[model samples]
Target chain A: MTKRPRYFNLEPIMNPKSIAVIGASDNPDKIGHVILANNVASGFRGAIYPININASGTIMGYTAYKSILDVKEKVDLAVVAVPAEVVPKVVEECGRAGVRGIIVVSGGFSEVGRKDLQDKVTRSGMKYNIPIIGPNCLGVTDSYSKIDTLFLPAAKIDKPVVGGVSFASQSGAVGSSVLDMIDNEGFGLARFISYGNAAVVDEVDILNYLADDEKTKVIVFYIEGVQRGKEFIEAAKRAALKKPIVVSKGGMTDEGAKAAHSHTAALAGSHQAYEAVFKQFGFIMADDIQELLNLSKIFETQPLPKGRRIAILTNGGGTGVLATDALYEHGLQIAEMSKKTVESLRKVMPPIVNVRLPLDMAGDAEKTRFEAALAAFEADPKIDAIIAIALFQTPGADENVAAKLVEYGTKMRKPMVVVSPGGSYTKRQRQIIEKGGVPVYESPGEAAKALAALASYAEYRDSHVKKSR
Target chain B: MALVEYFEAERLLKKYKIRSVESRYVKSAEEAEKFSAGGRIVLKAVSGKALHKSKSGLVVAGISGGEIGKAYSALERRAAKYRPYRILAQKMVHGGIEIIIGGSEDVQFGKMILLGLGGIYVEAFKDFALRVCPINMEEALSMIRQLRSRKIIAPDRASEKMVAELILKAARMYQGGRMKELDLNPIIIHDGTYDAVDIRMIK
Candidate 1:
C-alpha cells in the first residue's frame, strides 16, 4: 500500500458554511452577478455575503458589502470574480479578512503570460495558509452542499441531479460543457470543479478530497496537465483503491499541447509519460468526454465484473457483431456458454436463433426472450458479465425489457450494460433502463466499452488486493 | 547532454549487476587481433559522436581471428570522419531474441523506463512499453506483456523473469540519477540467459 501524506483539507472550499461573493454587481451581464445569482438560485444553505467596492444597495437579494473587509461575519470561502489585474490585491484582502478558501473565477494571470502577478496571488494564499482554487476557472459546484459557483447561467447549463459521480477539471469550458451534457444524458453528479490555472489547489488536492468525500462514489477528471506528477499519482492511486477514477486528458498531440498551455498554463508533457502513470495507478483512461462519462456512469452504478468473459445478448445481429468486435478490441473475451446454459437458452430462444456467444435473438426478441437470455447468462458460470442490446426500434420489443434487465441484473450479481440506440422511442427506453439502475448506451460499442472498463477495474482491484494481502 | 563512451557505459552496467558481453578495447589492429584470438568476434569502432555504427560501416560482425585485422582497419578508416576512435573486440553472440531496454528522465514524470523489441526492425515495429522508474517486478513483467510480440516470451518463464529483472535493475540504476538517459539495445536472450550487447548513455 502506498502511504498517503496529509493533503490540505478542502472542506471549507467545497462545503463552506458561509460564502462571500466578491465583485458582486447589479449588472446581469457581469460574471460576478451571474455567479452570485447561481449561488442564490441553487439554494446554498450557507450564509451569502456579496462584496462590492462601490455598490451599497442590495444585490441578488443579498445586501452588498463595500468590500470583504466590511463583512463582519466570518467567511469560510470567498468566490472572487473580479478582473485579472485586481485579482492579486483581492486575494491579499481575502487572506487578511481570514477567509479559509478562495475561488478565483476571473481569468488573466499566468495563462496570459502574467506569471509574476499569478505568483503574487499564490503567495498571498500561501502566506495566510488559505487554499486558492483557480485564477482562471469556472469554480466549483457541490450538489450535496447546494453550492454552485459556476458563472454559467442555469438556463444554458442545467445542473445534474445529485449522485455519486464527481468531476474535477483543468479546463472550465470543457467542465461546464460536460456538466451540461451529463444533465441531458440523465447522469447525475455529486460535485464538479473546474480549477483552471490551478494556482494553489490543483487536481491532486481535489482528488484527495474527493477520495474521502462520502457523496463522491466515482471520481472523474478532465486533466490537461499535472503540476506535481508524483503527488498526483500517489493521490490517485489511493483514491482509486476506494473508488473508481476515470480520466480524460487533453494535449495528447503536439498541436494540442500548445492550446492546453495557452488555455490553462499547463505543462502538457509527453502523452506516453501520462499513459504509464495512469496504467501504474490503475486509472481508467478515457479517450474522449463521452467515454469518460460512460466509464464514470458504469463505475457509479454497476459492480465490477469478476472476470473478462462477457456474454453478448442482443436482438439485432448487427449490434451483436459490433459488440463482439468491440469486446475483442478492448481485450475482453466472448464467453463460451456451458451446455446447461445453452440448453436453457435453447428452450426459450427460437430454432432460428443460434446459441452462440453473441446470441442474437433476431429483431423480434421481446421481453420474454430477454428474460430467458438473462437467466441463462446469470446461471452460466463461464459468463462473468453481459451486454444486452435492447433496441426499442424493433416492433416486438417492449419497455418491460428494462424491468427484466433490472430483475436479472440484481439477481445475477454480475455487471450488465444495455445498448438501446435509436430516435425518440429508443431514448425513452434508455431512460427507463437508466431509471431501473442499469447504464444504457446509444451504441453496442459503447456498451462493450463500459463492460471493458468494469472488467479492467475489477482485475486491477483484485491484483492490488492480492498484493496487499 | 554529454555522451558517455561505449566502454564507460559497459562498465557502469556491469557495476549495477547487469550482464554485458565481455569486450576489450584496442587502439591498434594488432591489439584487435590479440583480443579476437579466442573465438568469433565482432569488431566495432568506438566513437562518442557516431550513433549508428553499423549504418556507417563502423561495425563488422562474424570476424574470426584472421579477419580481425582487416575488419579493424576497415572500421577505423570508415570512422575516420570522427577521428580519435578506438576499436572494440566483442565475442560474437548468436541465436537470441533482440530486445531493447532503456530509461530517460522525463520533464514531468521524472525517470521512466522503456522496454521494446530491438535489432534492425526496431524502428519499423516500434513496439514498446513504458513505466515510471522504481517499478516492482510485477510492473516490469506487465511492461513486457504489453508488447505486441508478447507471445515470443510467454512460453519461456525463465526468459520472462530475466527480462523483468533486467527492467527493474535498469529502473533502479536510472533512479540513481547519474545518467540522464540510457539505452541497452539488442540485449540478446537465449535459453533464459541474456547479454547486453550494446550500451549507450547520456549524462
Candidate 2:
C-alpha cells in the first residue's frame, strides 16, 4: 500500500484488493452501519474490515478493530463515516497506517462554513502523500469492479447493471437519482463517482483516469463549477479525444450560480465561458438532465455517423414530419435518397408508402415494411444515419416489428436510433430493442438530437486530427 | 481600473500587426488643425474617467481641417468636468460594417478573445462569440460562424479571413500579461481591409 510517484495507479483506490470501514456501527440510523451493510451486499471482490473505537466484539459478523492502525491486514481504501470534527484525527491515523486512499463520506465541512476543518483534513492527506476523495460526498460506485462506497441504502438507490457508460458528478442527490434511472434507461454503467466538495481528488483527476479506463467507452459528467480551468481544459481535451464526453453544467443563470457557490463552495465561471470551452474542446454539452442521458446512451450503443445527412423512416406520418423539423433544428440534413434506392423501395413498398427522404410507411406498416425501409436507407451511401419511428401502439406493429427494429438499429455500419413513445406495450418493446444493444429515445426531438450529436462528434474527430493521411 | 492612454493603445494594436486608425495628441487648437491635414477627422477628449466617451458626446466626428478647431473646443467643454487628460484628432473612417473585438482575462480561465456586432447596438443585441486565446485559424473561423448577425455584414471569404486575422492579432496583443483588457470596437471592414476605429485598453 505504498504511494508511488508519477506512475501511481488509481486502480487500488477504486478496485482495491481490500478495504476497511471506519466507524462501522451496529445502529441502523448511523450512516456507517448502512455503508458496511452495502459492502457486504454489493459482493465487492475484496476483503472487508470493520473498525470501531467502542466495539468489543465482532460487528456485522466480522472481526472489529478499535482503530485503522490496529487492523492487521493492509487497508487499501478506508471509507470514513464519522463526525466532521473528528475526521481530521481519524484521517491522520489512517495516513500513519499507510492507507492507500480514503473516502470521507461525512458532511458539515466547508459547505457549512467550516473551511478550517476541511483545510486540516486536506493538509493531513498532503503530508502523507495520500489521495482523498471528499469530506462531504457519496464516494464512487464501479459496477463491473464492484467497489460500491455510496452511503445510501441499497433499497433506496438501485444499482445499474454493468455496461460501457461511466458517470461522475459533484452532487450526491443528483448522482444517486441518476444511478437509479440508469437501470430504467436500459443502459448499464461502468462507474459513478460523486466528489462532493472535492477536497482532494477533483474533476480533472477523474477525467484523466477515465481517459485510460478500458471498461469506459463513453464518459458523462454533471459538474456545477470548475476551479482549475487550465488543467480542466487540457484534461477534457485528452479524454474527449479518446471517447465522447457528455457534460451538463448546472449553474448557468445568475440565480443558479449563487446557489452553486453556496452548495459546494464552487466558483462558477460565466455561462458564456463554460459554453465556449465545451464547444472548443469537442465535449458534447446538453441542456438538461434528460438530454445528457439521451446523448450519452447513443454514443455507448451506436457506431459513429459519417456525416450530418440522416434519413427518417417512420410508421406514422405525423412523426415523420416532426422528425424533419427536429433534424433541421439540430443542423442535420435530410438526406437525398439515391434514385436506385428510391426505385428499389418503390417496387417493394405499397403505393400508400411515400418513398422519399421521410419514408413514411403508413400506420399499417408491419415488420417487413420496417425491414425494407431500413435496408434501403442502410444501403444508401448518401445517408449517414437513420431514424426509425416505431409506434408499437399502431395496429400492424407487433412483437415481430420490435425484433426487426432491434436487428436493424444495432447494425455496426451506420448509426440508427428508434423513437417509440407510448404506454406499457411500447415500453416492453423498447426493453427488447435496448436489450439487443440499440438505443431508443422517447420523442422525435430527442432522437434527432442524439443522432445530431453523434454526427457532430464524428465530424470533429475527422477534422481535428494531427497526422496527415 | 486605469485606462491606457488612447495613443498608447493604438500603438500596441499596431505593434501586434493589427491595422488601426491613426490619431495624434493635440495640446492646442492649432495642433488639432495641423493633425487633421485638411481631411475629414474626428475630435475626442481623452481621460481616465471618460470610459464611455463616445456615448457622452465627448467625440465629434467628420470635421474638416477648417472646422477641426470648433469640434475640438466642443469636445473639450463636454469633457472638462471629467478633468480631461488630452485632446485627440483622428482620421474619420467609414464605409463598412462595424465589428467589436475584445480580449480579457477571465477569472477561472486565462486570456480569452471576444467578437461581436459593434457600435451602439453592441449592448442591446449582445450577439457575440468568445474563445480562449492563442486561437488558431479554424477556431477563429468557428467564432465568426457563431455570430448571429454574420450575414448582415454580407461576409465573403476575404472578409471572414481578415476578421479571423484580426482576432489572432488581438490574441497576440493581449498576451504577455502586461495589460488587462483590449477592446477594438467598431472596426470598419472596408472592401479591401479593416481599420480598428477605436482602441481602448485597461490595466
Candidate 3:
C-alpha cells in the first residue's frame, strides 16, 4: 500500500466520455480517417466529434466541426492527427476549449530533428495545463473505455479483449506489433499507450497513472529510451509496490543506441545503469519481445506464489531436467515433495517413474496419473507452485491432459503452468490450455522463467511491505 | 581528460568518509625505502601526465626494505616520460578479495555507481552491477546481491554489510558532482571492513 500522488492527472486520457477527432478525413488512406474509423467501429460509448477545418461538413456519418471551440458539447479528449507545424496551435486551441486530454498523432517533431516544433508543443501543453500524449505517437487504446486512438487499422490488427495488463510503449512499431500478438495469444489487454517522442507526457506519467488504475493488474513498458532517469526510477518504484512492472528496453549496444536516437530522438542511456535500476527496484526485465510476452502471460493470470519452491510434473523425463536447470539458473529451488506425498505418488504411478523433485511420469502417463501427481503437489505444503510438462505427442497424453492442466489452473490457488512442445498437434493443445487460462509455454525453460518472475515479484512485494513497516 | 592526483583523490575519499589504506607520499627512492620497513609494500605512481600506470611499468609490489630502493629507481626510469610524477608507499594488504567500486556520470541517468570484481579479472570477466547514485543502504546491499561472483565476498555476511555501507559512504563524494569518475579498485575485504588499495579519479 502506497498511495498514488494527486499530480499527473491522466484519468480522462484513458476513459474520456466524449472525444473529438481532429483532422477527420473522408479519404480512407489518410491516418486521420483510419483513427476516426477506429473510434466509429469500436465499443466506445462516448460522443465522437469529428473536427475538420471546414466546420460545416460531415465526416464518418458524424457532424463535423470547423474547430473544437465551435462544438457546444463538453469534450473530454481530443485526438489531433494534423500536420506537425500546426500541432502547437491546435493544442493551444484544445486547451481553450477546456479539453481535459489531447493525443497528438501528428509526426515531424523531435524524432526528425525538429526540436523547435517539439518545444512549442511542450510549451502549449504546460500553458493550458492539458496533458498531451505526443506530437508523434500512436496514442492510446483503452479496451474497457472503448477509447481507441492508435492510428493502426482495426480490421488488419485485431484488438485484444479487455483484461488487466496495461502497456506504455515509447516505440509505436513495437506497440502495434505487441497489440497484434496479444490478440493472437488470446490474452486480454486493458490499455495500450504509444507515447512517441514524449514531448509533453512521458513514460513517468504513464507509470504513475497505471499504478493507481484498478483495471491494470500489471504494467509493461517497451522503452527504447527514457526522458528523465531519476523521475522514471522514482515513479516506477512507486508503481511496483502495487503491481508488477515488466520492462523491455531496446538499444543496449552502442550501435543500437544510435538507431534509437534516430528513431525517437532519445539519448539511449547507459544500459548498465538502467539494468541496475530495474534489478534493485524489483522491476522484471524481459530480454526480448518473446520474453516480454512470456512474462506478461503469467503476471496477467496467476497469483503470486507463497514461496520460491516449485514442483515440476512432466510426462517427458528430458524436459524435466531442462526445466530444473532453468529453475536453478533463475535462483529458484526445486520443491522436494514430502515423504508421504511421494509415497502415494510412487504407489499410484508406474514402477519406472522416478518419485522425486521433477517427478517425471514417463512419456505414456495418462491424464489420471497427471491429475494424481498434481493433487499430491497441491496438497503438499512444500510446493508453492507447479509446472506441468505435458507433451501432447505421447500416446496416453491427449486433450484430457490439457483439460486437467486447465482444471488445475481454474481450481488451484497456487500458480501453475504447462510446457508442451511439438508440431501442429502440440501447438493446438497448448492453445487449448492457454485459452482455458493456464499459461502453456513452448519450452520447459520458458515455464521455469515465468515461475521465477512470479517468485521474484512475490519476494519483492513481501520485502517492500516489510520495509514500509 | 586527466587523472586526478593520487593525494587529492585520497583526500576527497577521506572527506566523504570512504575508507582507504594509509599511505605516505614519497618523492625519492630513499624515502620510499623507509616507508616499507614494517612489511611488504605496494607502490603506485601518481601523476596527471601518467595515463597508464601499470602499462608504463610505474607500479611495483612485494619489495622488501632493501629492494625498495632498486624497485623505486626502475619505476622512476620507466616513468621518466611523465616529468611530474610522485609515488605513494603502503604496507601490502595481504591476500584479500579484490573488488572495485566506482561512481561516475551517466549521460542520461546523471550520477551512477558500479561495483565489480577487481584486478585483472574486472577486464577479463566484466562481472559488475550498478545503480543510480544517492542510493540507500538497502539498495547498496541489493547491488552486491546481483553480482555473479557475490559468493566470494559473502564468506562473512558482516563483510558484505561493510562493503554495502562503504558504497553508501563513498556515494557522498560522487554526490558532490565534481568527479567525472571515481574508481576504487582492489579494495581488500577483511572481516568487518575493507581497505581501498587504489583510488583513481578523473575530473
User: Which pairs of residues clash in candidate 2, taking residues 3 or more apart in a chain or in different chains?
Assistant: none
- Which 10-residue window of candidate 1 chain A scores lowest in summed lDDT? A259-268
User: DockQ ranking from best to worst?
Assistant: 3, 1, 2
Give the per-residue lDDT of model 3 (tens digit) for A310-421: 9998888889999999889888899888988989998899888878878889989998999999899889999999989988889999899889889998688899988888
Please give the CA lDDT of all the candidate structures.
0.83, 0.83, 0.83
Per-residue lDDT tens digits for candidate 1, residues A203-225, read 88898999999999999999988
TM-score against native, each model: 0.93, 0.94, 0.93
Candidate 2: tens digits of C-alpha lDDT, residues B1-203: 56787767777776788898888888877887787788788888877776777876788888886687777777778888889467777888867788888776667777778888887757778878888877888888888888887776536887888888888888778885377666778788886788988877778
Candidate 2 per-residue lDDT, tens place, A25-132, comes to: 888888889888888888886888889989878889988889999988899999999999999999999999989989999999999999988987878777777778
- Mind giving the per-residue lDDT tens digits that candidate 3 earns over B22-89? 79988787887777775889887766766556766788988877888888888878777787888888
Predicted complexes: DockQ each: 0.40, 0.39, 0.43
The C-alpha stretches of model 2 lying farther than 4 A from their native spots are A1-9, A254-269, A467-469, B28-39, B65-70
DockQ of 1: 0.40
The candidate that achieves the highest DockQ relative to the unseen native structure? 3
Model 1 vs. true fold: TM: 0.93
